[model samples]
Target: MRKTLPLIIFITLTGTMYALGQSAKAIIPLGGNAWVTGKATITDDGLTNWENPQDAISIYFRVDKAAELTFALRVRVPEGKSKISVTIGKHTFSKQVANTGFDTLSIGKVMLQPGYIKVDLKGISRSGNVYADVTDLIVEGVQSANELTYVRTGSSFHFGRRGPSVHLRYNIPQEIKKDVKWFYNEITVPQKMDVIGSYFMADGFSGGYFGMQVNSDTERRVLFSVWSPFNTDDPKSIPDSLRIKLLTKGDKVHGGEFGDEGSGGQSYLLYPWQAGKTYAFLLEAAPDKLYNSTTYTAWFKETGTDKWLLIASFSRPQTFGYLTDLYSFVENFEPDNGDKIRMAYYTNQWLGDSAGKWHAVTGAKYTGDETARKNYRKDYSGGLKDGRLYLRNGGFFDDLTPLNQKLEYRTSLPPPMIDFNQLPR
Candidate 1:
């Protein structure tokens, strides 16, 4: 037999790829009570390990589903390098630090999937000495789904008649696929009701209107409003007066007055809508001639009370010769608090044909609160109820009857809550 030379087999792996070393796929625990073993190399030469080699850090964790991640960090830089790099998965995010003593560093948004996730922190200094410290770290949107929801109260007269319009818009992340739904309660104002003109039926009005929109594409905008006529001279035609109301749950407790009359004008309440969820709405209106000329519109929301608070109002004259005569007076406007508020309006336009020479007036009001101010993005953003264009037995309204007018409304589901327990240690 010929002697075959024994062949020697040798395999070599380097860095984090060695068989005897930790596998790149291995899960590592970090943060709050997690165990890790690697001696940090420290040096004062302002070169070797940079600043204090002891500052380099690493974290590991697993996710149950793919998600959008955000990290909020407060950092302090002493005097070396102005750049810091964060390594996660196969991507690296770098941030530039101002030479200032303290600053906020955001890692922005990152898409992450289920499995082991490792984050490596590396800082580089100018003279070779990098010094920095991370005080807080917050990761959001992992192991959770997005949802949205809304609630409305009140009703609108002339069921099919399109009234005023309210619009809403939001920015959505690309990672989520969501389902949406809308809910509402249409109420009718009772005869001889004690409530103000255009107020809710339960509060005693002749007609009412309410509706909401939900889960709208963050890229697309959503609108809600009551539709009515702009001219009333032809009693055989729809009238042109529109009114709305505003209230808040916190008003009474805060010693704020509630009504449709004042120099502060009308008020409006606001709410923050989550990216994915369902919402419900209620719209109400009444057109009785005896009290119909008094147009009333307001916005209200819960502020830790059972009853809605009046935060904004939209009221104007119903029998004006010109649409330009309509104007809105807003008051008590704030824009910081987050919550969807309610709005109400009244009009005699429903008299349809009985009223003549319709003059449309459109106005907006804000409750003087931090939240309402933040929402509309203006000291006030409404004007006298004005007709964009007059329609005299025209296209969409030619054969339209108060009972046959088209009415549209919308709302959505609630957003998903994040699971803090599943976060990387």
Candidate 2:
């Protein structure tokens, strides 16, 4: 009886262990966390229109601890049959799926360490007209699911893939905070960090923003934009009297109106700006009390060049103010390149008071947008480095700066020497 009792206790313990392992489960919606690098696309309904075998879907999620995770996909084969494979690190699992309706099929398991994991799915072969429509990726055996990070369901998939946007808010000296007329800053993208869809904004005020962007593999641009006083996403809905007017622009700069984010006056100069080279941005805000409006001007130039090219000067209606709320930021604008890391170094930040005296910007605070604040994504980082403030986002790096951390520069640099009289009219 004693020997039989010991065996019964052992059996009970083993059964309990198996039950615990089966209970750890998490469902990651592909609509928010997946990216299709090929012709296929992931929409609100999840992955769809996967007609090509070359289409590769990369889904990202982070686990907090090392565990053997079993994966399953809630998917459907709209036509015949397809053989697909999911690759995680060195381990690969294949399955032949023929479910015509939505169902969760187990894709097998792999051992992974704590960090961001990429699940790469591709069609090995398809007997149907198309591949498969996958809606979700499921994982089991994670001890703690709350600590994991990924794009949660019901969030924005387009922005989820774009990752987080990070910023460095400059601390203006108390006396000149409200009367600052000009903001001067510099940016340099280090080698291999000039990623496509990256916008390295140098001057950001309360009313408008100015920056440089990697539009594509063959195109780069210096862009400036001013939000309209009328609050609407469609520019046409804005009354003509409330619209922003272009006062003037430099040669080869395109000045127009833009929408979708916010209705605003947009201008950009297509310059082949290279990485690892310092560039300078200068912005001016002049208020006209007579007309109750403010005029904003921007200029960009290579640090070593003597010439400063004008981006565009815009007159904003229904506003009267100098530059307020100065800051700098870095963001990934393209959902396709959000998985890649990008960074920008901002230095020599200085602002001019109404009296034309420049004050050194010595302090700043790191902040992120709603995506970072809600913790939907955790790949953003910002801090002081080499006496300069750097902003980094995307690539799913493990180090994320705490939101709203105040920072001060350790090195003092000379204020930029500029002859106001020589600036282009």
Candidate 2 local lDDT, 150-172, one digit each (tens): 87765787888888999988888
What local lDDT does model 1 show for residue 2? 90
Q: Candidate 2: misplaced stretches above 4 Å?
A: 1-24, 51-53, 143-145
Best by TM-score: 2
Off by over 4 Å in 1: 1-56, 99-102, 127-129, 143-425
RMSD of each: 23.5, 5.8
Q: Rate the local accuracy (lDDT) of all candidates.
A: 0.28, 0.87
What is the Å distance of residue 197 in model 1 from its true position?
78
Top model number, lDDT: 2
